[model samples]
Target: MPVFVKKVLAWGSLAFLIYFMAFRPEGAAQMFKAIGAALMMMAQGLGDFLTSLMT
Candidate 1:
């Protein structure tokens, strides 16, 4: 079903991320950390947006 497909895609994405982090970790480490920080910021922004919309 669609839910199974979504789970597969999510797991695939996670595997790719782990592979990238493991190999060529020098420059990639900083890049991945920066991306993780950006994602966290975006998540926080989304949460704030949703909270504001509710109130």
Candidate 2:
């Protein structure tokens, strides 16, 4: 994409996301919780794999 178009999309998405999250605080909380869980699971899986590899 062109630089101008990329900038427009970045700003547009930021504005839309801010509006959506602000409109539904509960939804934002749930979304963050899900994201945190996913990160935790990924980290645990990675650690296990590395430990097994080292062993």
Candidate 3:
């Protein structure tokens, strides 16, 4: 809620990401791949639900 807290979180997250990417590029790639798979699955599930509602 506070601007200071938001800035801290943003910078902290950026730093962590930079560290992870620099130290473990393979792990970062796998993490992104897993996240993409999860998002795809969620989108497919939502589409199925909407189709079922229509029929």
Candidate 4:
């Protein structure tokens, strides 16, 4: 995909997610919880990988 198209799609998806999270908090709580867990996992994995590289 072209860079602009990709950026637009990404931003659109983010906007939708934020919209629901803001206005439909009860309905979107599970999804937000999952996103939070995934982000935390990603951070921990990246930290471990970087530590290994430095050692």
lDDT of each: 0.91, 0.94, 0.99, 0.94
Candidate 1 lDDT by residue in tens digits, 1-55 = 6999999999999998888878868867889789999999999999999999999
Clashing pairs in 4: none
What's the true lDDT of residue 45 in model 3? 100
Instruction: Write out the backbone clash pairs for model 3.
Output: none
- Tell me the RMSD of model 4 versus the true structure: 3.6
Deviation (Å) of 12 in candidate 4 = 7.5
Give model 4's clash tally.
0
Higher-ranked by lDDT: 3 or 4? 3
lDDT of 1 at 35: 92
Model 3 ranges off by over 4 Å: none
TM-scores for all predictions = 0.53, 0.82, 0.91, 0.54
What is the TM-score of candidate 3? 0.91
lDDT for predicted candidate 4 compared with the true structure:
0.94
| Cα RMSD (angstroms) for every candidate in the order listed | 4.8, 1.2, 0.8, 3.6
lDDT of 3 by residue, 1-55 (tens): 9999999999999999999999999999999999999999999999999999999
- Which candidate, 1 or 2, would have the higher lDDT against the true structure? 2
Instruction: Give one digit per residue, the lDDT tens place, for model 4 in 1-55.
Output: 8999999999999999899989999879987788899999999999999999999
Could you tell me the lDDT of residue 11 within candidate 3?
Answer: 100
